[model samples]
Target chain A: MSGEQTAAIESDIEAAIREDHPALITYITAGDPSLEDTKEYVEALDCGGSDLIELGLPFSEPIAEGPTIQAAINRALDAGTTPARFFELVDELETDAPLLVMTYYNMILQYGSEPDVRPFVERAADAGLSGIIVPDLPAEEADPLRDACDEHGLDLVFIVAPTTAGERLDRIMSQVSGFAYVQARLGTTGARADVSNATHDSLTRLSAYDVPKAVGFGVSEGDHAAEIIEAGADGVIVGSALVDLIAEHGTGDAPAADALESKARELKRGARRGGEQRNGHEQGREEAPEPEQP
Target chain B: MSETESNPPAEDEPNRERTFGDYGGQYVPEALMPALQELEDAYQRYVLDNEDGFMDEFRERMRDFGGRPTPLQRADRLSKRYDREIYLKREDLVHGGAHKLNNALGQVLLAKYMGKERIIAETGAGQHGTATAMAATHLDMPCEIYMGRTDVNRQRPNVYRMRMNGAEVNPVDAGSGTLKEAINETMRDWATTVERTHYVIGSIVGPHPFPRLVRDFQSVISAEARDQIQEQAGRLPDSVVACAGGGSNTMGTFHEFVPDSSVDLYAVEAGGSSLEIDQDEGLAPNSATLSTGTDGVLHGAMTKLLQTTDGQIVESHSVSAGLDYAGVGPELSHLVDTGRVTPASVDDDAALNAFHRLSNLEGIIPALESSHALGFLEEAHEELGDLVVVNVSGRGDKDLETVLEETENRDLDAAPDVEVFDT
Candidate 1:
């Protein structure tokens, strides 16, 4: 876990996908149903199919979400999830998976950019996480925040929206190491059927940039995952669908937890087919109508 | 019948998410999830078993506590000018001084029955804030009010009254620092502490439960207005006019009446200047949602919103702070969309003039927001000399400071009679 180099990060992700296993990104709330669960989930995801475990820090207001997602957050918060707990969870989960943490910007602002955030990124590097994903903070807004993730030799992963301007994409591609998260819609994350045409246009437009772009939000099951990969995306991110699965299964004791873990692993098995075509859409299609102020 | 005795919900459980035809659901943040679920279960049970007797107590409270059947006062000066009889529902006479009390009293009592801890609410002009606090005080429950900093600066009297009633008033200083901002701030709070807090939203907006709950509490308005108007005039009024913010008051009074098309139900919006004749988006961006709002989702529900090509929530402004919301309630949106209701708006000056005119001529300080209803008196009058009822949703005492001779003068002074509006 210690003495991890930056080059070691990219190759690790490349190596994990080459295997028959779907790279599991562990998703635990920073200070959730309990931070103890954060530690538990990270360890579980690492032990299971999770290749890149993502630590999520909750905010009083996560603007980019719908009611269902919001309710899950509430239950987690009621259990007392927090920033310090997030660090502790990562500190304990010394796994081989590259720890990729995700959260809204305000949480970082509340915790601060320098000593507080930098050390956490360094800890992730130590704990074997490859990067950090701040979905709301794009590349332009990344500089001040990016420095901390970089200071620890951790890849600061930025997200590109369906509406990200071309110039912003180029700028983000140059600075954004690790893998980039391409949001599926103009608005916040939620589950929906059918990948919108706008998503296709974004991938084609961003193809010139040579970064590993993973299409996330609404990509569920192996079919959808394979379809996104076939659409030319480097990877597919399964969030709401997976979150829904975890919420359903992962709620009780060890037996119940193991039962949930099997289902989660089963989900990743389907995630591998994401490299093929899904539905009928070919590769890229032009899409418009992006929601304002994501 | 003895209170809470024998009477039971129509079905086995309370109608948790149903509100008449077009109201009710829980579209809120995750934190408030458990609370909404719990309350929905409780409200369904209580209302069904006690609804009949509850009305009796409601009437007693309205009569003994809230000044019953609040005068069907005739505004002769206004009526005379219109060549028709104009009647004011005089909701302003209610205790806490506005129609807001009708819904506040109903919900606060519901909260008490459910055994909730705190009453959380959001307000712009402080009318609903003050009214909710009054009800909470009577029930001896802890209450908290969220008001935008801008509204506190303007509606000082109402703000002070809310504080005096032992309600904690938290000033919101975010985005525009007004009603919407207060709503945003309250939402953040509700999402964080849903377990112990009953978010008593002031209007018929937000997701599901709010629109429905607020409407049920306010349905008493139309129930009373229907019976009262018949008793007073020997027949229904030709038109029922009320100002719309989230449109709860209007819907409450209009719903029971909407089925009566002969009763021309009209809800007026405060056109800050004019419902944007051209598209320049901003706070004062010309608004006319019912007049021009599109079908979209906002706050949490799919309804009507004043947005752009890209569904961005637009900032709306009006001389009446209460009527300055960017979106209308879903029921109203459905009403307008279905042509079940006719929508109207009066620019800042017209509403201001109506406010002062009602104050000086009738010796009644009508809420500036309600003045938008008064602003339509002449137009509403044109159709008939038949009975016309305008819901005086609140007292203008909170607005007297601003709508004086110098009223929204700048907009009114330079403006020509709105051309879009043809006589």
Candidate 2:
């Protein structure tokens, strides 16, 4: 839990955002089929061009997840995924990309014999986790966890929904470390056939915040990644789409790891293509606009 | 807590405390924060401040449509049997046959004032759904209810009652298909439809404004009972007992009397078959959260919960669907922790026995949820002072099938003989 270790996630995300292309963030439920499979999947995602990976510590009541991830969580829980076991998996993982633990607030609150956030945050930092994402912990109730994360030097990422606005949005942005998770839609996390219009509006709304913005929710394919990135997101997050692959192929299946790797590669390429197109359009507009000025 | 101080400030003061001690807070997704904020504003203006004659209309509607001020009857047979003056707060007499309408009606009316176009809610035993449906129909608002598929099948009559009152019952089939899942599904709906829809949480649970909001509406139960007992019995009762599930009725019956230190408040939970939790299976054999639960966050609030050592919420059990919840209201958790309210529990057999005893002795059939309180009285009446007031939270009409099926499986000492009649 050293200060240098705690700053890993924010620094890694910042470096990734500074690259020529938008950062690609991939998510998979830890211990979905088995912890061994999760380790392999994380390595695959990292090698396939993921800038950061989020490992879900399965909670029994994941109100923030949709059917695909919920089924994966139930599978992980049935296979006996616990907070202690999740940390052990994180400790064992070897990946090029920094890792974060996405879980419900209760798991952190009840990590020890009593309800305290420090014990869990300290353990997360020790396990080499760069940041933590709690969908249920809004800015209004995030002070204790934020303080704990600050003390532990781990980033505390907050999700900003389309409905989020005004003073609340300002408060959340001020507290957020690493990248602010910008929900691409108004609902819970799931993969959709197309990117939502709300994604563009939300990115515009969050333009004033200094934190890097990563758009998630309803992001399914390479095109979705490209669309979100083109609309001005620093990163693109895909979860349900990757989890759907695990659900389709049992973790024991040899192709499961390969499927995740291929999907990650495609999403990363789309993000790069989007960055090139946006830069080209901006340069074209700058060169052609002077004569039309009134 | 004083009535005025209990109302939170309208503005979002960063330092304002939204919790009851260490419990309660808006532990919900960012999408629902605006809805909670809007609801808080509406609650403060219309509910606490009574803006636009809101409280006047609400009280008038309760009297005209909901049969408010349900009588406080002195149970003659129960008084003699317990050797004390037993008073029953007859909440079962409220319209829709449960104390649920007190909160449901108030929330629905408040939604109308806030200009919400639709209403949504979740129910376990269907009492809350039925009450909300009735209120919505009475108020001319569209309504929908999320009910577990398991409960939808078992509580058919209440399901039909809800449908008859014009509510679409969506059966949630996820994770055990029970109250917990229904609540999650309802929350999911609210998260997506926050602007146009208002989710009427049936109990005094959930985030900051809801627990306080629901409590204010349901407090009418104690508001009347406290005055009724003083006039009827010439003094306040020594002990007040109510069943605890999500604790709407318990909080409703206890809110007015909490400051009266002389009077004792008891929240009787359903002990089911046992209190021992099977850690390996992630199951708790009872719904006795107040009695044996640890502090954990659930359903948007930091409350007492039945959870495993690894922080996984365990599946809870109770023969009575209404009492089958793993979490209790955060306010109740604070009350129990501070020792303002005593926590007790009764087994399923005892609750079943009390259901029959009240029917046979006093000609009043009690809901299985309410039977838990009656069972507690039967177990510890001698310790209660000369006067005791018990809240009959609902009628037993919805529990006839469940009681009959459960009674046939066990030999309840007080159960009336029911030999199968020749078909």
Candidate 3:
């Protein structure tokens, strides 16, 4: 808590990996129902054992998002969510887990003067944001913003897709400070009943690097989370499912928090299942080696 | 016209960077980077420099199916009226009734070579949609086109034509229901279905390779016009003029002649209401990105875009649905910066006037988009040399309803006043 923001995020992820626990990252579009609801949702996620919280700065067009997240963004925009409002909401968050802002490149590019993305990273640092993820800004086009983020003590996370080439993956991994986001599928963000082999393959490829690799997109259930963790993902990132839960059960409903709490716990249990099985082979005769910190 | 004519072309600037100044880069999501790279590699290997006869096959298809080498006809009647040499590059004679076929045919063929099973496209004015449909049918590929609800309603004939040619048209009602929103939807579709699908972008726009590739395919218009004009008119035209929307036709007609110092390139934008109107007043004049726009990214590429100070893309207004756009192609933006391509705008009123003039005087109906280029003739008459080739990008068959309505409105305005008295 006393160190720099990005260093704190890196250490936090490293600590989780050392503990042999998959970091549970929860994402919700800020100001979906309202900013107030979002604040409560953040607290709920933190209490529910989320290792990291991703606040979606709603854009007019969320192209990478599917129906659920897109509708959430639309609702947030209708509620008059702006980048200023997003930062303001983030300023109000009092949570144990690190907070990151996920947004499109244009929103950040538009925040300051033309062609200068530094102001955004400066503002994120000033606002106490641990990291920033631009899903649309690939590593190749992320140099300017990445430099600014590095200057402002903000971790710049890049996305690695199933379709990403080996060389491009290496390039992305080289630049990432926080965990690298590995898309769980070839399509837009949505929840599916079963994860595809492509997801496992992407995670396996991403595992070669030293970066913490978290898998998202179509990660809806505990089994889905477990499948990814079993395949060697360091973290599980869930978005649509939580948004869907929020939609089904209003923030006012006790069941909503309960559902989130249970879901988080179940996914955590699923995450531990892989390590537990590994430990079972030793049968208490020998202890497993502790994961190294970054 | 004054600035473009006086300013010289920057022959050295094209080699600067991957971007056109600060415009034209891959501004899309990371999910699309691999796809764009794959496309670039495929384009270089299979289409541009492959040992296989892919380029030949593409040319053969362009010749047999697309009817390439569309004529460059000298406009004798228009020349006499304007008292200037005016010629037309007949893209209208292309199989799909516009230059859109050039891009569609090449992309669909590329998609075929890449082993993609389906083709997806976004279209405005239905010209690109109809052309994509034609390519899809000819290649026996599944095709889906996203069209704005307003465009679908207005360009009903082209919509019908798209369906008749075997393509599904998804009507997008988002964001003023125009070309911009349609592109957003198509990008979403491509993101989800990139494995089996290829996005056949209709213009010299979008992210890299798209603008470059589409311009390369459509450049045949100017290439042919360059030679055809030399053979017929016995010299290069003084200026090359084409309507600019996403700027494929204009770039196609202008790209080959970029190094030609003497040849002036003029891009006529759809002036909609008027480029002179205050953009903040909620009355946006479409296709004036070059005139009243600042450089910003939209639809994927960094380009001159009609946007707010906060970078929110402003909706463009145009009577010509084909020319209704908030952003121009990135290369056009560079050309505009280097004073290579001169940006000219024609309001809806004048474009309609030109549409009527061409129909009546030359017995040829031009699309409202093409009418913008014809509309520029009034301004360029003084600057014209012995030869000026205007890219007649498309025929006006799809615009009959809009033309007929405007004509009726004009006729009603001209009707004699009648007074009625009751006893």
Candidate 4:
């Protein structure tokens, strides 16, 4: 973040994979409960073994969110979360893990407007943010933001839905740099009973790319994380489950942080188990050291 | 060589690359992309292809079920007042009482062809919802309609009509609890149930393919009126007018006349109070996207929308539920940019006056949405030609409750001393 250029998000994932573990990415609404506690939660999630943390800048209308994340966003908005405030929170955040901002495209489009340029990318870069993920901005409409992100040396992550067609998939995979986000189901984000077979099939289609892939949306439990990682995902993203924890346990209590940390460890454990199983049968593969569990 | 092959293919605008300057694009989540692409392909394959007989079947439904070729009536009394020949393209005579059934029946048929088992739509005034429910019942398919809770309260009779037709009505309470919020809920439902569901978008204002497809289905209104005006008036009318909510009725009433350069096209928007008022007050004008809104994205398409400087979509207000949206269709925005269409605004009070005037003068109860078009007649340029055609887009049956309430309120305000005790 200083004189030395920050490591690319792919490099961070590679390093984690070299240690025989798939990355565990966690998402939380930045101002849910409170913005002050949000800063503390980021560091705690990192300490708890999360490889990356995605800060969801709350919006008034979250069209793609289910009831859980929608409630989190409503609470955050009620608590007064604005783009300026979220950027200030990011500027003050102190964490070793890579930080990414997740929001709708309009939120970024509104914050800064120039002729054929995105100001949000430069603002995010100035805030020491590593990457950005906009759920509504597809590859067909991502050129301006992608160019801005490239100029700012920030990663612009793209998503791959289960129903993504072949040609559209090729277009989406072309520009994404941080990692490709793989939606685990055909719907909005929420906890579900099981991961669909379509996810594995979609991963098989995406396996042609060198980019790390993270499975989100309904990857709530440890087994779900393991299933996705085993199906060839490089990481697992757990959002609603983690946000629900903060919602259930008051953010003022220590048990909230403890519960979050414990959930992070469980997901990391599943990721590691999946990674081991991937290379266990191949004795010719290089043996890697394991990172300590939380 | 085949006729189509020899003809070098007709220039198809609907099938053209989808964008309007910087407005219309896929702004939806990745999960809905595949379904959108699939719908685009199916639409072109089944509905757009005239040789498939699919469009013939759709036209049959429009004739037998929807009572197509709605009469073009002369508004002689109103014409005398405005000093012009005003003819009303009476879409109110169509079954289900509005121009919405044109798009609804077309899409519901397409859904049946695509093997979808469920259909869903979002509505504000309940015209589109009732139309969709009617189409679903005719096809014997299950239907669900999402309405804003606020709108459901005001539009109770339509709610009962939908339920009576066996369509489930879901009242959405999020956001301003209006058309835009209902659209969000319907999109959510489609994203989750794309495997077996078809979303019958009510207007021409969503992501690509939808805007194009809906406009195509509704183009029949102008097509019929164009022929009728030519036969009766000896030429195309001097001006064509309709109210703009999401711009469907206007687009339908304006498209065929677009190529006729001599004809002027005017789109009347719902000016709730006035265009200059602050939108946050909940009393400001609505459907003024071309007049007061800036370029932005809303409900998946880039278009002119009422939004804050920070890009939050603002709630729009109108006495007429059908014309109460905050955004206009992308194509309408494009037409405005190119100067092909003139956008005018009529406030709620003026629209109500026109509503009662049309009712008393012509013995026709006009929907409030249609009244906006009639209200614009008062401000027509003095130099314009005598013949003008305005689309009477819907009947007023569904708005009876709201109209009665407003009439009572106006009467009370007119006479403060009058008081009646409950019997």
Candidate 5:
């Protein structure tokens, strides 16, 4: 809180996470069609140049989640996926992606939601994971995760929104390291063609800060990815879109790992292109000459 | 995700957009969404049934069993010292020894009519559990009560009483071993048993229809106070004071007073130890809902809670177990935030001292929870003269163990504890 991640994370927010110069983040649920596909998709995103990846593990009663996530969870649960199995698969994998595995608190608590976190975390780093975001577990209760991330040098990501307060931001920022996952809006995970201007303004507002922030929960295509970056976001995360891709490419075969690999490649390409645009814009702002002595 | 057009109709009461004015709305799991909507619809239709039948049935029980017209008596000694007319609504005098009987009877009756099979309840201090168990047993409905392990041990007598009354008791060990955990356990149980089980939430802290329904059931206190003040003192009291643990009595008395601009509603909370100590106590920690809570949520209902930065539930402390809740009842949250209700805290020492003072001066033994109300009187009664109504939610029997330990060997008349605080 006093030193480690705040100063470094803050500057990133204004230019990186904000829509003005953003990062394009893409998401795919773990064990969605199958565990193999989920891991493969994460690796594919990394290979394709996506800035960040949000890997979701399905749960039963996701009280805060919307219909899109609810369906993804059901599909995963139907495939015999559990938090324990998800963590196990992540432990076994060797990916070159920064994995942000998200899941519920109860499921986490039920099955080493704490003890099991350390392994995948270290493994994620080996495989190239940068951060993690679990929505249901609020920042205050994120005990072991905060400590684990510090010990392992992994990013324990925190989510903030327009609805978040200044006082709260300080506390949340205290617990998280790496970068903040700034939600595009309030409510559960979903994507919509018509994004709110207010949402965009909030992302832009955050970009004015210094924390390296990532925008998540929507942004379907190359254009949307480009828009988030232009608005100052360091990362633009696509989830339901990738889930849609997995649904399209998936077969009833074992794991469906290829589906995720293919989807991750496309999302990573789009998101990286967005990040490049952000870096370019920030450079432009930097290179802009001092105003001519009026 | 986008918030939809789900605000309830704007009425005079305009409940936090659900209508009880900042006091009511829908906040629950998606699984329970349809059920909540159905309950709201059923409640809407029942408002039409203002059928004298329900009201008449309520009065019948109040008179025959539940104890009707809880007396409005003056606390003679305190009144004289403060120069204010401090009248007490003796909900404590009711058959089950608390105000909870009023709501329990009302809810069980509603269940009987709704054709629910089994009844499930959550108890913090065990008062609500005991009362609900007694009522359901009286009405021949199967009852189950979930209590946190810590509470069950602290409030052993009530736990034993509930078990004896033929109610099954499940002890939960989650969260901070208090009401919040009890509530979470009850919610899970309700989801499993929702179809046949009528979750008679003890306080106005759950989803929509509950805040409104429990308040409606308990509102008789204020209705009577309005008439009692006119009949006895010839005017409405200037200020209404009640201890707010999950806020049943406070809501009961304040409901009639809230719409009355002239009458002030002040809810007293447990302020354990000193201001610093009180802030640190979990007896319902320094949850300044009325002052700080916006229209967000913590528990199952849309109420005020002292949440962590990432929205984790914070534990609260009060010498009074019932008030040892993390969240305030929804209406109380609304009342405090919207400027309709004024909330203040009295630390445990002040309440304990006042507890002794009441025993000495008025010869009336007050529950530790209710001592909070008197603590307010001892502190601020100088300004409020000739007009104050206090709700004595229960007898000191449930709190006798703690009382004896705190104020042991210190007495005025020493009426032998009355075996349960005799009138």
Candidate 6:
């Protein structure tokens, strides 16, 4: 069962990319408002055409998160979220989108007092999680987590920043599995108004890797998702924008779930539009007459 | 200046190991990796190799501007009171009124050499912020400090000092509005500005290169104390004591003497109100990581942390704002685990008493953080051999208001009568 779940992440990503639309990955802090509300939100994302869903297991100190996610994490923690509670949320989640747990390293390292990662990874796999994303654990310190994930048949995903290059880039690319999270900008996770120019460069850098490249950070709207797909990303990860809606509307309300689904659908449509445009350009070039030999 | 001017070129080698027996690592986001690498390269070149005489310039500036070679004065009154030889390494004499300037000056100088135009740091109690602001101003770099709003309100003088030294102080209001939140905010800032900025970490904590880098810069405390003690006392002391917050002064005071098996090192932590944690509140009413903490990651390093069984970091408390931290330096954790250093703790009442005791007996006011070590001296002086050296990490001017108020509220044996001056 764990093996199938493990393969589901890569296959689901591949399936999304193979279609006319790029994959859409949406993130939200689990247990926010409440775990029951979280399950409903996950369903909303899946119904809205999300290919992958990331459930944040909120840590006490989330150094990689900006103001929006930080506020969301605080809310989740206040709702009594713990590792055990997070796993229960995974067990109860009903969704077609492949699930990934995103958190800080200490949550995985301190799951049990034996100072090993196996306990957390094995439990995550058993709970039906397809992969794990730890923002603070770089490739240099990823060996232990990677080994644990491999033993548990879970994908160990890594985030590649805009500044990543040369030997460091090689190190990260080698360690990454399922999909490489390409940070669109050089900062913590949050929403921004403009799509960064560095998105194209980061995607071009990761093009050599066989793994799918999903661009994230500052991707707040449908146009941002479209721009990322046109820039050669295999997917777009949206978090704070959806979280803003959740914050605006209280949990268990129909309007809150509807708002999340609406945003996800808009973003997915934009992604498909961008993919169609790119495919058209490629086909046009292929059908164009070759240059005459001089 | 020309004492053996002929020196060999530094060996070109990669940076040293990132961990102290599995206690330290670069547990940070991917965006900060390149900056760490760049800083590592600069650390090797300028700090380790003294490329273009960087260390030489650092030493000269420290001597002229920052006042290095702080005296290791024998505390005659303290020795007589304790019935043992007690010596004080007066790091309190350094510029910016604490040992914080040692690492701040070195990192700020290294940043200039690395061609960085901006400097940033996080501080609790505003000690590190003041030091970094002074260093940046001395080196003519634009400086900014992230301090908790709680600390800014509590330690107003230090905030003013930092601002007067020409630094932008950004108040962080996240979480408990304390040191931990301040550090997180600084890391966020550095993530965005890593290309043109350098973050001057306050202590022997953080990821690879930072702990080692700060230790190397701060080891001057022990380097000077080791020679001064031998020169004054005719031999190495039996025990060396220093207060451990994030363990900068502790590591600095003990690093040079760690090789001497006969020299016992004691890291004194803050016991705050109690040792027992309020589990429901997720609060540890102490900052005694060396004595009571378990292995966990915080502030980019895998170190000993005052965290709950479920892995959430609990809020830590101490009378001394500088010592109120949930996590400690990884190297100190390694040392305590290996049994090379003994871990001890002193409660708030004892620390406050010692604050007044030192002022009355030695005619020198001691920082509350350093008073924890002095407090331990009152508790375990006989156990520590006949000769002991205590690191006075800073002066107590900043803690005057806190100490006076605390003393007024509590009945302390050493505290002078304040009722006479009630008017």
lDDT by residue (A1-294, candidate 5, tens digit) is 124634454322232233322344667777777776665666666666554556776644444555566567667766767555676776666543345667654333334223244654565555444556666455544566577766766666777755555655667656556566776754456667845464586776665455565666555666666666566666667787767766766555534345545655564456556666666666687875442111
lDDT of 3 by residue, A1-294 (tens): 112434444444445434546778889899887888888778888888788889999776567888889888877877777788888888878887888999887778888876578887888888888889887787778889878976877778788887886788777777777778888887788878998898878877766677788889999888888778878888889999998987788645334667777777777677667445534544465775653322
The residue-by-residue lDDT of candidate 6 on A1-294, one tens digit each, is 113335454444455444524889999899777888888899999899898999999888999999999999999999999898889879887687889999999899889766678899999989988889999999999888988887877778899998999999987776667778999998888989989989988888877776678899999889888888877887899998888888889756534788899899999988877776666676687974432111
What's the true lDDT of residue A154 in model 1?
Answer: 66
Which parts of model 5 are misplaced by more than 4 Å? A1-294, B1-11, B14-24, B274-288, B291-295, B408-423
Stretches of candidate 1 exceeding 4 Å from the true structure: A1-294, B1-26, B51-56, B277-287, B408-423
Where does model 3 sit among the CAPRI classes? medium
Question: In candidate 4, which residue ranges exceed 4 Å CA deviation?
Answer: A1-20, A113-117, A250-255, A281-294, B1-14, B276-285, B381-384, B411-423
The digit string of per-residue lDDT tens for model 4 on B256-365 reads: 77877788999999988767646344334566888887777777888887876656667788889899988889989988988999988898777877787788788888
lDDT of each: 0.65, 0.90, 0.80, 0.82, 0.67, 0.89
lDDT digits (tens) for residues B276-366 of candidate 3? 5453443466669887788767778888888666555667888888888888899999889988888988987778888888877777788
lDDT of 1 by residue, A1-294 (tens): 111344444545555444433343435454445565556555665666666666666643445554445555656655656555666666676776666777655345445332134555555576666677764454533565578766766667666665456455567667756666776765456567778676688788878776667777666555555556657676666556545654665555422235335545754655555442322233334342331111
Local accuracy of candidate 5 as per-residue lDDT tens digits, B54-171: 6677678877988788889987877888877889888888888888888898888777766789999989889999999999988999999999999988889999999999999999
Candidate 2 at A151: error in angstroms? 1.7
Residue clash pairs of candidate 3: A136-B29
TM-score of each: 0.59, 0.95, 0.89, 0.91, 0.60, 0.95
DockQ of each: 0.03, 0.76, 0.58, 0.64, 0.03, 0.77
Interface RMSDs of the predictions, in order, are 15.1, 0.7, 1.6, 1.5, 11.9, 0.8
User: How does residue A212 of candidate 1 score in lDDT?
Assistant: 68
Which is better, 2 or 4, measured by DockQ? Answer: 2
Please report, as a residue range, the 10-residue window in candidate 5 chain B with the lowest summed lDDT: B1-10
The residue pairs found clashing in candidate 2 are: none
lDDT of 2 by residue, B1-423 (tens): 112212222423322357988899999999999999899899879987899999999999999999998999999999999999999999999998999999999999999999999999999999999999999999999999999999998889989999999999999988999999999999988988888999999999998799999988999998888888888888888999999999999999999888788999999999999999999999998999999999999999999999998788998999889999999999999999999999999999999999999999999999999999999999999988999999999999999988988888899999977657315
